[model samples]
Target: MSRTQSIQPLIASRSAAHRAARSRIVSLVLAIACLAALVFSISGGEYSITPAKVVQILFGGGEGLENTIIWQWRMPRAAAALIFGAGLAVSGAVFQSLTRNPLGSPDIIGFSTGAYTGALLALTVAGGGFALTSFGALLGGLLTALLVYLLAWRNGTAGFRLILVGIGVSAALASFNHYLVLRAELDVAMAAAVWGAGSLNGVTWAGVIPVSIVVILALLGVLIGSKSLQMLQMGDDLASALGMRVERAKLVLVVLAVLLIAAVTALAGPIAFVALVSPQLARRLVGSGSLNLIPTALTGAFLLAFGDLLAQRLFAPIQLPVGVVTVCIGGAYLVYLLNRGTQKIRS
Candidate 1:
């Protein structure tokens, strides 16, 4: 090649290196922020444990109410928020990459609604046990995802078609959930309503363990397939030409994303829009074209932990659901995205 061509490749390599460095720095900052949010969440709440005391209790230096509150109440809640947020963020990132559209999140594309539908049915029939509810949610989300794929698959699944079909299915499922709630017994309906609002209140270690395991497994799957996901961003034809198994990779990714959302929904009742907003926010923070999973995960954890803290203390003696807080934030962000001219839906 000519001298100019050789210089161009070297310059491009340097540019890529610089972008990678910037993405790493942003990820580190987000990780620190998430840790700080966790500490703040553990330290706040009704009794107002100091950060120092919280750390002390964490290390087995405290006794009585202090220990109980730290170990039993705060730790589980914080862990749930962190794990659930990370799972949702990674799931969102994968789908957005697959669709090549920022709007293609699990919550926006019908998975959350489908999971809610399943959970509502389980609550009505199975009397609201966690295991049964989770199983129901997983099955429902998987079926809904399959339905969307089938409906959108006229000439290989187009991103916009999938999104449009998903929205329609999600709306219908949401109406079904409402109707089911209405038909339920008064006490059962009330319980379903509360759970559906997605609060972290009363989260215990027993509930946290299973969900954490699922989230961890899903996250590992995402990490392992991250390279193929990146390849898919170049469009299916190009990916296939490069020897990637486009269809199989896409199927695995979609299934993993659905499972992650279902597991989190089962634990926290579809905490609204964390999946929708976290990847977008992380993308902005890390600059364009850099899919930094760590930053996205950390951004999610911080948002949920901080939102839960606000929910607890914002209106003293009357805590709001974490979902409510996230909905408000997500709604505002949606408006902002629309006003600023969002990325067009890819075909």
Candidate 2:
């Protein structure tokens, strides 16, 4: 009300605007990086094509081997990496915001493990078809989420409690997955192991199309509810005071995030740590207290695409799963994070 008080509020407003502008710039840079990674991924295989040639092929100018490699192979794999990365990152951001914990990522909190369990079960018992595997993954992830929530709920879910319960559930599910894999025939077990390692190899347009649609829809859902998510991050009492239905909003957020995680896992075989690391990296880049969904998604796309590129080229003719690369990187990051001390949920 006083002049000094009014000036202080104006200063805060200016600072907020400056931070928002910086965040937008960072997001744009990340988007460009992701695009560059996609191009590199598409053009960097054994029979290398230049970016110009890749573009030419996309524009229907190239033919024969170039056409088959770019259109039939590289494009689908690149597309899968991009979409799956974005989905996982957005899912991670939503869960982290919902739980107010840095470790609340889908991978860390049992969703990935649960999806893996489901896929393994489908492969071993249900004879391993795409539709059945996807269904199993979704069902498994959702059930694990429900179990974690129930275990963590005394009156309402707390971030630390949920994380603890999720870790336990994840451990149990990991054992279950191993058991299923061991029970399968040798060929089936080998195939399941390969899938579990999360290769982007052999992705065809048929698989990519449905995955793209699902990722797009799930991402739109996250964006639509982004405002509620932001409010929810300010603690349940404040969010309720601001006229948000905290519980309902949280439930919706959880469902959307789970759908994203489960869908990506079904498509990509529980690709490790993109969901966990991307959002954290994006937050560090933007220096934002609130979630930056677009930046997170872009960071994820870049990581996955780049990782896939490395996986393909690093061993030359002996391609590794993209998950192996990511796990190596993410595991190092996790160690660094632990050394930096645990970040607790903000009240």
Candidate 3:
């Protein structure tokens, strides 16, 4: 081989190493930012605790009221925001990778709405306990995803078709959800409406614990399957030629992503747009074609924790849902994406 060819390999190696290092640095910075957001979230609510006191309570050093407030209230809310946000972000990254479209997020399509539909059914028809609602959300999301996937698969799954089908399914599910809520008793409808708004106001350990566990497991599956997911982005033929079981891999990743979506939806209602925005934002920040998951997850956690904090303190006495803030931000981002004119969806 020529000297130039030898040098090309070295150049490629150096470039890859540089990207890896940059990804790590970005992830570290995002992690620090997430911690700062968490601290602020825990310290800034109605019964305000100082940062030092919040730290003290976190470390098992504070007295009764401080301990009760932080441990009982703030911690659970913050934890839910972080955990749920991370799950949403990772799910976004997976779909975006699979579809090769920035707009291919769960909320953008139909999974979140489907999950909401399921939760509404559990509430209106089944008397809406937490466990039943969670199961319902999971079932709804899975069913919606399956429907969209099958509808989109003409010859094979095309990214653009999947998105369009998802959008249609989401509209239909949203309509069905409203009908269910409307037909329910006044008290039940009111309760479902509150949940549908995706508030973290009354989040507790009971909700947070199960969600955290499921999210963590799903995230682990994502991490393990991430390589195959990236390969799928290269096109199905190429991925198959490279010895991947493309269909099976796609199915696994989709299931995992749906689980993340369902678990969060069950606990916090259909908090929108984190899944739509986080991965793209992280990709931009890291300047990587295949962005690392850690930075995306950390960015998501910070967005949500900070959003929840704003929700709590923005109005002081009356708290808004975190979903409201995310919708505003995500809506703005969506408009920007549209204005920039995203490439046509792949057929």
Candidate 4:
């Protein structure tokens, strides 16, 4: 073989090895971070549960107050962080692939707002609306996503047109949602607003069950579509040329993405930024050269769990919304990206 031909195999082998090593490194770092976060999360609040007590509680060894705090309060929040993080990250990954745009998320498409609107309507109009919000949110999410899909479709859909329609729908829904909240009684409005801001403080087993089931199933669906996702990112014609069912794959992804976002939003309000930044952050961390669902999910979980933990403890008496914190951070990142875009043109 010629020298260039001989060197090609060696380069491929080294590239493979490097990818494997990077994956292992990410797994190790993320594992350590997750463990530390769990311990800190358990220990962060008042009443001072030791790490040992936390572990004991986790293992079902404690009782009464400590167990109550850990088992009833912190455990659900922590588990929520895990599931929320992973679900958002996976959903973001799929949407970005489908739209071929990093900014795409359920929130951008009106699905989240629709879910929020549904939740709001239940709380304000359902006559037991408070108790029925989640179901309402689920229905709203599905309807809004379907509506966006139909509106965006004109024989075949273009990602750009769909996004524009989604944006318009989102704006309209936001107005309707605000109007409903404003019309309601102050006490009811305050309660719904707090729930809308998304905190894990009062999450019950009842709320957890449905969200967990739907998100897990949706997560599996996204994973199954990953190969199609990679192809979809290359654009419609190229994806079709590869014998992939481009339209079908897009539909499945849109559905899974909608479902994932709907489940999380219904469970925790619109926990902002995880769906926006997690995938991009994951892509950066795992390298621009590869796609990694597991690592992305793990990192997303870490960021959200840690963010929620901070939100709960940071102000103590004031108790800022977890969504508020994520949004503040996410908003700053958005500014940076915008500035970076200007810098690109200057250079």
Candidate 5:
């Protein structure tokens, strides 16, 4: 009825269009960056295949040695890094949105530690085949999530309470994991130690294929529930008033997020900080408050690919685990976040 009211709708529509366009643009840039990182990872190892040869190999045109290096070796590792990174980033976005907390990531909480504990158990008790270890890790992560959820639930789960409970549980799990490793035989301990470090060193197609499938499927589930996830951000009461089954929605989203991160941890041994940092970084980059899953996933893929490259190339003869690089980066990022928070409180 009013002219101002008529103009308000047009303004809001334009703002939405602007944000949508920006998100698309940011996603495209991040995707290109991820692709570039993948290419570099495939091409620039110690063996040093050229980018052109990398492309040829990817498309089925390279010679024997080149094909072996690309297909059998580098491609799997590179693919794992990219795929796992994307999954971790999406999982981070889900938890952060769920908790309305920047610090709410699977790794930061206790899920990763729980997964590690499971992997350790598999190694020590079950002879530690990859599939068995992966299963153990998945089971461990899910169980840990359940425990944390139960502990954090009062009248209902609050984000801060969940995070605090997760941190405490994570510390206890880490101690138990260390004890398990210490009690294992020498060779088994060595293997568990390497796994706990979260290296991508020996990642092969056998491992990568199964993980890729699980992550892809779980990511789809997250995408389908994205609407309910955002609505839940408006608070349980509000979301329920809007006809959502709040607890059920939270359960589904939590399970999907857990599945994504657990699959990655099962394969790569809890590669840290990607899930914690990727979503926050994506939000800042996209200039939006709502979840930016696409950009976050792309950023994660790029970070891991690039970090893997650094791991391989950094020490020349000795390749560090990809986890080492991410931990360092994540540590610095954590400090920065703390400093920023402190400054805000002081102000």
Candidate 6:
């Protein structure tokens, strides 16, 4: 065989090997995510169920209320965490890809703040039920994102300008939420506050079903548009040069991210940081510089699932909000990232 032909075959073989390696890495990550889910599903709070028992209960081979406990109660919480994590991670990946900035997650962009505001309004002003509250959160989140987009449109969006505008909007919304909490009746405010702290403590399977349906559908939507999203990351000029509709793709991703963020926010309250950190973490784990949405989503599932477990299990009788644990850890990481970024800029 000619050297040229031989070299081409070798290159193709190496490329195939690389792809296989990445596939294996993804498989490992997903397997770990499952184990984490199983571990957390049974090992929390006063019940102290074993993973084996939990598995049996889940699959319909258990004696006693272990079945009910796992199926009705813990299952919902565990499912919520998994769905919440995956949604946030995917949303973060979407935002980061579109904005071409690491700090471009929906929470960072003030979308979550908007959702929280809507939820607060529902709870306090509207006196709405759970369904209404969920709708309100969805409305608030989508509206905030739209408003930010409008305000940030000055001829066109520069990535950094969009980020700055979003940060400003998010900060304002946070302040407004605080004011709303203070102004509401004590019981109402307390309810809102406790929920705002971010717990999966009481989420039933009913709640889980709705949130899961929404998250799964929206994730499927994002994946369907993945090619467009990848093209989007190449920047407007290049994407346009390549015959891709830059604005349309960005709009789709923005809407998808908003939907994912709103869905989880409605179900779990504003849990903070999963969306911010998970995609970055996933990328590092998978050794991909680009968005690996599936792996990132799985990584998110693991992070939130385990965090919920720790919050519920570690405290004995006192059940901390799953959100509280993530925020504490996420907060520390955020500070570290900011400080590191600042130091690099200064140096």
Per-candidate TM-scores read 0.95, 0.95, 0.96, 0.93, 0.97, 0.93
The candidate, 1 or 3, that scores higher on lDDT is 3
Better of 2 and 6 by TM-score: 2
- Model 2 misses residue 81 by how many Å? 0.6
lDDT of 2 by residue, 161-180 (tens): 88999999999998888889
lDDT tens digits, residues 128-201, model 1? 79899999999888999999999989867778888899989999998999999999999999988988988888
Error in Å for residue 44 of model 1: 1.7
Candidate 4 lDDT at 174 equals 90
The TM-score measured for candidate 2 stands at 0.95
Off by over 4 Å in 3: 342-347
- Expressed as tens digits, the lDDT of each residue in 169-247 for candidate 5 is 9999999998998999999999889879898998899999999999999998998898998898888889989998888
- Candidate 3: Cα lDDT at 83: 91
**Model 6 global lDDT (CA atoms, 0 to 1):** 0.84
Which 10-residue window of candidate 1 scores lowest in summed lDDT? 338-347
Clashes of 4: 1
- lDDT per prediction? 0.87, 0.88, 0.90, 0.80, 0.89, 0.84
lDDT per residue, candidate 4, 1-347, as tens digits?
Answer: 89999999999999888887887788679867887787778776767888877876777788888878887777777788778888987887777667766667676768888888888888888743434877888788889988998998987778778878988999999999889989999988988789788777677667777788889999998888788888778789998998988788888888888888888887788777787787778777767545678788888788888888788788885667788888887788767877987898999
Query: Would you give me the overall lDDT of model 1?
Result: 0.87
Lowest summed lDDT across 10 adjacent residues in model 6 is found at 36-45
Instruction: In angstroms, give how far residue 9 of model 6 lies from its true place.
Output: 9.4
Best by TM-score: 5
Question: What is the overall TM-score of model 3 with all chains considered together?
Answer: 0.96
